[model samples]
Target: MKQWIFLVGAIISEVVATLSLKAGMDNSIFYIVVLIGYVLAFVFLTKALKSGMALGVAYGIWGACGVAMTAFLSHLIFNEPLTSIMVLGIVVIIAGVLMIELGSQAATRKEKGNV
Candidate 1:
């Protein structure tokens, strides 16, 4: 419950940090936000990992979701192109991440059953 929220927060912070990096490219002021956001992002990520979520699943979801969100944000904010192939790739990554999370959970459950 709270762990999921922390995960979500971490992802959002990562996205913000990336955006801030872009913004900081022109002005040094935004670098502060970028640094703070990155630190907070990792802090929340560590907390989420400690909250009993599978490492493989949590990291996979975090990475894939971050990539997807970054791509979408780049399109919206920077007017970056979004081709059909790119969209398909993002979707596939999302699906793969979900599969990894599910598989890890199933494996953990099975391991517990064995013990």
Candidate 2:
């Protein structure tokens, strides 16, 4: 549970960092935010890894969620248009992440001879 918290933090950090990149284009101060956001993101990601979350599972979730969240946030923050196809792609990304998570759990259970 703690590991998941770290992972969530990591994801949020990454998303913020990515958005900060766009903001940084206009103001140099936002560049500082971008750097700090990325650094904190990696720090939390490392903590999640140290806490025993599988790399594949953690990375998959992080990347997929980041992409989805970034898209949504861009739409809200930048007034970017989100087409139906883009929304469908986000749904597919989420489904894939879910599949990865389920597979990871099954693998762990099998390793423990619980399957």
Query: Per-candidate TM vs. native?
Result: 0.92, 0.97
Best by lDDT: 2
What lDDT score goes with residue 28 in model 2? 80
- Name model 2 segments beyond 4 Å from true: none
Candidate 1, pairs of clashing residues: none
Task: List model 2 lDDT by residue over 42-105, tens digit each.
Answer: 9999999999999998998999999999999999998988999999999999999899999999
RMSD (CA, angstroms), candidate 1: 1.8
Q: Residue-wise lDDT of candidate 1 within 35-66, one digit each (tens)?
A: 99999899989999888777787788889999
- Candidate 2: give its CA RMSD in angstroms: 0.7
